[model samples]
Target chain A: DQQVKQNSPSLSVQEGRISILNCDYTNSMFDYFLWYKKYPAEGPTFLISISSIKDKNEDGRFTVFLNKSAKHLSLHIVPSQPGDSAVYFCAASDFINTGTASKLTFGTGTRLQVTL
Target chain B: DAGITQSPRHKVTETGTPVTLRCHQTENHRYMYWYRQDPGHGLRLLPYSYGVKDTDKGEVSDGYSVSRSKTEDFLLTLESATSSQTSVYFCAISDDRELLGDEQFFGPGTRLTVL
Candidate 1:
């Protein structure tokens, strides 16, 4: 079963606009969530993350908001740039429930396209 | 890529043949991982090693085996390859010096095709 789900396959947004990627998880045991951005032919890179205890975390232009009750989290990129266009994968880790704290369950991923 | 290099970036092999992929890291991060990426599936863990001679199975470790004889190298072997095993594989490393050691750096990727 897919514990993490990214329902949207792709998203298109204009430059200087906001791009939001959504992810949902079925397991409430997941306490830490992260977002990774991947380009074609390249491996994914860490973007942002948030703990279940906090509702939001921001780093520069990228922000991650978590809602523990809904089992949902979103990555928001404000004033999206062309460089931001890539496949975004949301990953969750059940640090509190598992010994392998580094183990992560990833969603299918959502491709974000920034238009000129 | 965090000093991680996966050799044999692309390979093609016939079914039932054995194939091995290598992941080498210069950083000596202490934690290594293998994952496969497919069209519908984002990325699934295959096997991982915490240190030399210390390894564990992951989510999708059925047809794969891994060995980490040294701190800098992790090898994944697919004995009797199957067409279903053809996919892009990635190797990641993590430094668990802190409690939140969830950040993992990935290698470029290795594309394998089983004919």
Candidate 2:
């Protein structure tokens, strides 16, 4: 079963504009969410993350919004640059404790393209 | 990009042949995991190791097996390759599991093809 879903396969935006990618999860036990960006021929790298206790977390150019009620999270990129063009994977994990190991559930991913 | 390396970056094998992929890490992270990436299927976990000699099966661990004899090395073996098993495999590492998902760094990845 696919606990997480990213209905959009791809998205396009102009450079210096805002880009938003959405993800939905079916498992209610998940307590943490993360976004990873990947380029061609390379593995994904960590971009941003948000805890269930919080609604929004922002980095320099990336922001992650988590809505626990709806079990949905979104990644927002402001003034997106051409470098931002890549596949974005949304992942979630359930909380146990600081010492316990948690496995992540991932969505299919959304390919974002930024053009100048 | 992490301190991890996957051997045989690209390999093409025939069906029913035994194959092994190696993931070696230099960071000495306590947690290690193996995942496969396929189009429209995202990343699916195969198996993971929490500590040396400590391992567990993931959602898609049927045809795969993993072993960790040392803290820095994790190995994945396919008993008999199948056409459906062709995919890009990634090895990830993380230190602690935080309230918000801990960051897991991925290796360059190994692309395997079964003919």
Candidate 3:
């Protein structure tokens, strides 16, 4: 079973517009969520993350909003740029007893294309 | 980005052959992991290591084996190659003090094709 799910396979948006990507989770034990961006033939790079304690977190042009009651989260980018065109993945993880070996469960990923 | 490197960036092998992929890290992080990415499947964890000689299976570990003899190296072996195993594999590492779900730095990934 997929603990995290990104239902949208692809999205297209024009430059200077806001881009929103959504994700859902089924596991309640997950206490932290992360977003990663990937380019073709490259490994996913860390983007932004949010803890369960907070509802929202922002980093520069990227923002992540989480709704615990709904078991959902989203990443928003303002004034999307062509450089933002890539596949985005949402990952979730639960706390570990040792605090060193937390495992991550990832979504199917959403491909975002920014048109000029 | 985390001083991680995956060797044999691209490889094509015939079915039934044994294949091994190597992940090397200079970060000396306590945790290391291997994941496979495929179309529509996202990234699926195959195995992870907490320390040298301490490893565990992830969601998808069938037909695969892993070993960590040193802190800087993690190896994944395919006992017998199958077409179903054709996918891009990634290696990730994070420090011990990092919180759960903290950022995981990944290697460039290795693409493997089994025919």
Predicted structure with the largest lDDT when compared to the true one: 3
How do the residues A1-116 of candidate 3 rate in per-residue lDDT, one tens digit apiece?
Answer: 77899999999999999999999999999988999999998999999999999999999999999999999999999989999999999999875564465678999999999999
lDDT of 2 by residue, B82-109 (tens): 9999999999988766432477899989
DockQ (Cα-based) per candidate? Answer: 0.63, 0.65, 0.73
Deviation in Å, model 2, residue A67 alpha carbon: 1.0
Residues A4-116 of candidate 2: C-alpha lDDT, one tens digit per residue = 99999999999999999999999988888999999988989999999889999999989999998888999999999999999999999864243476778899999999999
Per-residue lDDT of candidate 1, residues A1-116 (tens digit): 99999999999999999999999999988878999999999999999988889999999999999998899999999989999999999999764122344688899999999999
Which lDDT value does model 2 have at A68? 86
State the weakest 10-residue window (summed lDDT) of model 1 chain A.
Answer: A93-102
lDDT by residue for model 1 (B1-115), tens: 4798998999999999999999999987878899999988999989888778988888998989999999999999999999999999999988662743688889999999999
All candidates: TM-score of chain A: 0.95, 0.95, 0.96
* Greater-TM-score candidate between 1 and 3: 3
Q: After superposition, which runs of candidate 2 have C-alpha atoms over 4 Å from their true positions?
A: A95-99, B98-101
Report residue B38 deviation for candidate 1 (angstroms).
0.5
* TM-score for each of the candidates: 0.96, 0.96, 0.97
Residue A28, candidate 2: alpha-carbon lDDT? 89
If both were scored by lDDT, which would come out higher, candidate 1 or candidate 3? 3
